[model samples]
Target: MFRDRGPAWRQANAGHVSLGQLKVTSAIESCRRASLGGHVERSEDCVHTQIAYNACRNRHCPKCQGAAAKQWLAEREADLLPVLYFHVVFTLPAGIADIAYQNKAVIYDLVFKASAETLTTIAADPKHLGARIGITSVLHSWGSALTQHPHVHMIVPGGGISPDGTRWVSCRPGFFLPVRVLSRLYRRLLLEKLIATHKAGRPYVFGNQTPLADAQAFAAHLAPLRNAEWVVYAKRPFGGPEAVLAYLSRYTHRVAIANSRLIALDQHGVTFRWKDYRVEGRGRQKIMILATGEFIRRFLIHVLPKGFNRIRHYGLLARGACAGNIARARELLAIKKREDAPTETIADADKPRCPCCGGRMILIELFVRGETPRHSPAAPTRAIRIDTS
Candidate 1:
């Protein structure tokens, strides 16, 4: 689709697209192509050789995230506690989401800070868990249909350490926290910070939101949202630590749409699958067709500001305190070390294999961009076998 419509779409929406988005598009289009250069690998057993091109490695590139997700999940496996984990989502109202589109760096950072503070504040309250909890928050800017629906997905353990850091304070068997309470506090905290940010003239307003540049106009624009009920959804607790890893693997490195979801791209449009959360059962999985230009526009809108870390850890899971906190929690729970855990270290996933013989493919030659390899196989092949491990 990009090969056919990319140039036209960029020309039409030249003013709307950002340089970062353009770079992402260029990188993804050139990924695994001869223009980016690659290496030659020969199979250990069968002498089967192929030219493996370099991936773009853009975080938003769907083709590049599979290996990243695996590596990330492997690291997170150690961070998981034995207790039940909860999946909580903090969503912005339509009003806020629109503003966030223009002032992504400021608004998105506020979303993380506001959501993290809300969780930590509520969990530390005497009425609630009254313990210091850890949080893993991931920002997702798009909904299933590739629409701008900014939200944060939070993974939290069902328990936390006491204020004195003496004992573990666990929630009741099934419940994590009151969604209504979380929603109300989250709404209040975010709006307050947003108002402050606006007053300080930090958030940028553009295009349709140009009027919001004025203080009065922006205040009036946000007035209706103050009374609106923000969404704070908490799904059922995951069965175990392993289940949490399984869930994170899907979401942590997800792009707007995976290649597997593409059904067709032709004169009709770009057809893909999207889940309608409003519907139930089998009816929820529906097909959507969008114009190539519209699809590209939606995808580009989700390109995050450069240097923004979408995945953040707060409280006990924070970088500085994570190790100590995990140890303390385990000790408080009287949990024993796993004797049956895998003893071997994780193997490097970069190694490719031969398609025919299923043996390790060793790198034999390297080439620069637009340069041909010194040695070519008897039967030259561009299709390098991908390792599924």
Candidate 2:
């Protein structure tokens, strides 16, 4: 779809699109093609050969996330505690979402900071959990229907380490934190930061949002949101560490939409399946079609600013403290520790399998960008490549 209409769309929306989005679009269109180059692999038993092109590795590419998610999940496995995990979501109301769309880098970073602060502050209160907690937060910019719905999905352990570091603190079995309390604090902190950021001249407004460039107008725009009920939803506790892992696999590296959800892409437009979350039960799953240009636009809207980290760890799970905290938590829980596994790089991982004989396929040749492979995997059906490394 991008290859067919991308040029026209770019021309039409030239002023609105950013260079980062264009770069991602270009990468996705060229992914797994000869332009990016790849490797040639041959089956050990049969002389079957395959041409496996390199993935773009752009975070926004749907085809690129599977291996990335798998590798990331492997690294996070050891960090999981043998405890219930809570799923909490902090969503920006429409007013803030509009601003976020315009100033993604600034507003999105604020979202991360504000949300993290809210969680830690509330958790540390004596009346609440009263312990230092850890959280893994992933930001999702799009709703199921490809709308710009900015929200943060957080996976928090059901408990935390006591302030003194001498013991572990657990929330009630089914309850993690009060939603109303969380919602209120999150609203205050985020709005305060948003106002501060605007005053610092960090946010940019455009088109329909141009009026917000003025201080008074921006304040007025945000006034109603201050009183509105900010949504802070807490889902039921995950079954166990395994369930947490399963949930992480689904969301950690998700793109705007997966290719599997695409039903058709003819001239009529790009038809894809999207769930209407407002609907109940199975009826929520429905199909919708958009013009090729419109679909491309919506997809590109989620292309984040370059080098922005959408997935962040806070509190005990933070990079610097994770190891020590995890070890201490394990000690407090009286769980037996296992030997640490050696870290494996993508290249050191398992070899791809042969489609013909099911035997392992070994890398035979390497090619640089735009280079052609010497050996062609004649029967495309018999040539296999695993989307891992």
Candidate 3:
């Protein structure tokens, strides 16, 4: 399903993406070639060797996030503990929207930092029912309307440990952190960062074009944000381990809106469904129709800086001490490795088959790690994606 993306009739009217976006589009189109050990097999009669330049499988590349997600999940499977978890969202005020645009890399990074730090610091405080917590924060850059709306969705386990890190501290079954408290602190942290960054840079290099470019004007612009209630909503607890994985699957590598959500792209631009969060998500109530160029422009804004990791781990999952901490955590819980716990499976479907006998085919040779797949064929000419999102 990741392979075939044919140009859609809808994107026809959507034209002329910005200059900054061209390279990313090309990168997405060219990722994962046979040269990089991708699938490109030749037929029996072929004599000419084929050439396929492999894709640099980077997460920012829309084509590669899926493969990364699969590989990443395989590794994270070892990190999962048997615990119920909470889903918390941290959102920003639209007042900070313009500033975020001017400083996407830095501001986005701050969003991750502030949100994670807030959660970690608060959770660790003795007054707040302190305990070490595991959290997975995924950055989302777009709203359903394709706007550059940046927020971090955090999946935190329902409980944590004592401030001294001895015993587990559990929350009520339905609650995690206090939403009112999280929102108040999140707003303050973000506004402080926004003001600091604004003052640090040409803060108003483009202010001459704006009525709000002056210090007073900018201050006024940011004033309401001081009291604006930022949204920090917590969803009910997830069912269990598989549910958490399923939740991560949707969010961890999500693009603005999946091709599946696209309704139509026509003379008026593109029309897609977005949830009206202001109202209960009773139904897909709003239809956002955009000019094709504008739609492309909005989509391009989400492409992050090269190698910026949108998914992050905090607290116990921190890389440096993850293994030791997890071991200690398991011992505390008296959890032991299951004798029947599944190891990697070699699926029959993935095994080689005989062309002649319809029996399982034996591998006469194996390609070692540094070695390439055998008899690799040239990658196919670029195919058009008929699919749309």
Candidate 4:
């Protein structure tokens, strides 16, 4: 799709496209191509040679997240606890999505802060769990159709450490927190922060949302949502630690849409599979087709600000004290840490081997860009060595 329509889209929407978006487009287009450079591998049996191009390694690119996901999962494996895990989602009202698109960094950060505060505060209340729960929150900015729907998915352990730091406190078997209580608190906190941010002259309102720049107008804009029920959905506890890993693998490094979901791409548009959450049963799994320009626009809207982390940890899972906290929690629960296997260096063990004879291939030569790879064997000559200090 990029090769077919990227240039025209750029020319038409030059004023709207961000440098980050342009860079994503260029990287995706050039990924795995000779333009980015690559390495040539030859078979040990001298039967075949293959050229493997380099990857862009951009987080937003659909084709570049496999190795990244593996590495992330490896790191998270050590942090997993044996307790039941709950999946909770905090979503911003659609009315705020427009403003979020214009001020992504600010609004997204606000969403994380407000949501985190709501969870921790509610969980810490004496009437509730009254424990300092750990939270792993991942920010997702796109809905099924690639719309600008910003939400945070949190994985909360079924229990927490007591306030007195003396014992572990577990919630009821099935329940995490009251949705009604969480909704009210989240709404209040988010609105308060939004109003404060607007007052500080930091909120950016653009396009048809210009009227929201005024305090009164902005307040009025948020009036309906003040009493409206905010959606704080909590799924059932994961079956086990393996289930938690499986779930994280799906959400942690996901792009707006995976390349596998793309059914077709042509001059007409890009057609892909999408789940319509509003519908029920089989009707929900439907297909959506959007114009190439529209598709690109939707995808780019989800390009988060550079250096902004989409995944964050809080409370017991916070980076500064997570290790100590996890250790303490495990000790209190009378749980022993699993001994990890001895680490082995696999740098050479995992190298690709000849498909025909299963023999190792050695690097025989290096080729630069625009230079043809010489298939001929090197001529024997006297070795001349140069020394530089």
Candidate 5:
């Protein structure tokens, strides 16, 4: 179906090299083997790409992210809370940078487990406005610059249904968990676990470094983060239930950026835009051009280890009785059934909000042929507007 993935993607994998390309090839092979039954034959000439069997499109695959986004939103419809949802991000420090790369499977798991565990345990404490909260944690391994910045972005319901599952307890506006406290606890959890791994000799293979060979060096490397505050950046909550669903859409099965984000891929390498967080507000919106090789390097850094679950549901949202509990929550909220469940598809963009402004959002324009966005007179605007012009 994707005969041409734009010039940059094609050139990045021009030699059929890079981990992303290889993973894509593997996805195609797997899709062919795992039959989705078959599509109905048409009397009219088939317009859609009919290359072969379709991808199961698990979230982790670069190729499968599109399909996975659809399936994820459909299932997430059940978990939506009547109250607002917070966007909380927990990032790992570079103290364990090399280790996370080599042991992505294990370390990424620790990131998710620790971040979720911290949010739940803290929220459950009476001192911290005690209540059990449900969480959807997604692991992101790259920064906008394409560096290995492994972190977990959690979409947590602002308030959890009370322990008795009668009513929801909402958090104050602009306040989720305190980031400073969350950072301290998260740092401790990861360090303690990393130490245990080193002690067990299972995951730590500190190759050919006398300094790292000794536990003191390892302890010192981790010492900074002990007092050093790891970051827990909490974004403002989405406006309401629909906004929360839209928030999850951007992350569901996303790569560093979509293939379409890539602008060009001639011998000059690659040219694309990226956000620069060092600046505030609109200043952060900037375009970065990189060598083709560098683009490959950055994208590859985000490639998760095999079988790693980037998105995880925990607490009341966890599998087993948790699924039923969410349904009960739905009942309490006076919400009805998911009538569109059987026919749901991800392609419906649903005017998901602009990440910059927590205002009403709709696709203003759509692109074709890898072209830059052209402002047409017929373009759609938001229910509310923040003058970008």
Candidate 6:
């Protein structure tokens, strides 16, 4: 689909596509191809040979996420607490999504900051949980249909550490925090920071949002959101820490759309499956067809800025401090830490078995990109020898 549609999209959106988006497109086009270099493997019996191309490993490439997601989940599994985990979602209202699209890095960072402050502050209240909570937040910029709908999905422990750090404070069963309270605080904090950013001349505004370049215009745009009830939804608690890992496996490294979702590609357009949340029940699983340019445009809009982080940890789970905090929490709660399991290296696990004989395939040669494969009886001077055993 990219090969067929990418050129037209590039032509139509020239000068508008970001360097990050262009890099993503280029990487996707070259992913798992010999142009990026690869190795040749021969079966134990030397009767079968296979060429394995290196992956581009670009974060946005749908083909490269499986291994990355697995590795990430493996590391995260060790951090889980033997406690209930709640799934909370904080979403931006449509009024703000326009400005968010223009200032993705700034707005998304504020989303994380505001949401984290709301959760930790409320949980720290004496009338509430009165403890410090940990949060794992993942930002998603697209809805199911690939439209720009910015939101943060959070995996939060159902409880927190007491203010004095002496005890494990658990929230009431089946409850975390009041949604209305969280909504109000998040709205206030986000607006305050956004206005401050604009005043500092740091927030980006473009295209139809050029009016927001004026401070008064920007303030007027955010006026309605000040009184509006922002959306802060908390789903039922995860079954357990194990269930949280399963959920993260699906969401953590997800792209706007997976290759498996593409149903068809032709000169007319691309057809893909998408869920319509507004539709009720089974009817929501619907199909959408878009012209090639339109589809690419929608997908590329979600390409985040370079070096911007979409996943963040907060409070107790803050990276530098999580280890000590988690250890202390587990001890206070009388929860036993699971011993590390012996496991094969990722390469050993991912090594492909011979398709012809179901035997092991060993790397036999490494080829630099753009170099022609040698065909002579004698191996090339540059070929590195490997043990077949």
How many clashes (backbone N, Cα, C below 3 Å) per candidate? Answer: 0, 0, 12, 0, 0, 0
Residues 197-284, candidate 5: write the lDDT tens digits: 7777645554553366467777887787788768889888789889887777777778876766678767677777788889999999
Candidate 2 lDDT tens digits, 266-322 = 989999999999999999999999999889989989999888999999999999989
| Highest lDDT scorer | 2
> What is the alpha-carbon RMSD of candidate 6 to the true structure?
5.6
Q: Each prediction's Cα lDDT score?
A: 0.89, 0.92, 0.69, 0.88, 0.69, 0.89
Which runs in model 1 stand beyond 4 Å of their true positions?
A: 338-350, 378-389
Comparison by lDDT, 3 against 4, better one = 4
> Per-residue lDDT for 240-332 in model 4, tens only?
889998999999999999998999988679999999999999999999999988999998889988999999999999999999999988987
Q: What lDDT tens digits, residue by residue, belong to model 1 across residues 1-389? A: 77678888889888878999999989888888889889998889987888888888999899999988888887888788888899999998998888888889999999999999999999999898899999999999999999999999999999899999999999889998899999999999998999899888879887888999998898899899888889999999999988898899999999999999999999988999999999999999999999888899888899999999999999999989998999899899998765665555445455666777789988889998989888776475456799999
**lDDT score at residue 367, model 5, on the 0-100 scale:** 38
Decoy 1 TM-score against native: 0.94
Query: After best superposition, candidate 5 residue 190: deviation in angstroms?
Result: 1.7
Worst 10 residues of 4 by lDDT: 374-383
TM-score of each: 0.94, 0.94, 0.76, 0.91, 0.74, 0.93
- For candidate 1, the lDDT comes to 0.89
The alpha-carbon lDDT assigned to residue 198 of candidate 3 equals: 64
lDDT (tens digit, per residue) of candidate 6 on 148-246: 999999999999899888999999999999999999999999999989999999687878888889999999999988888889999999999889999
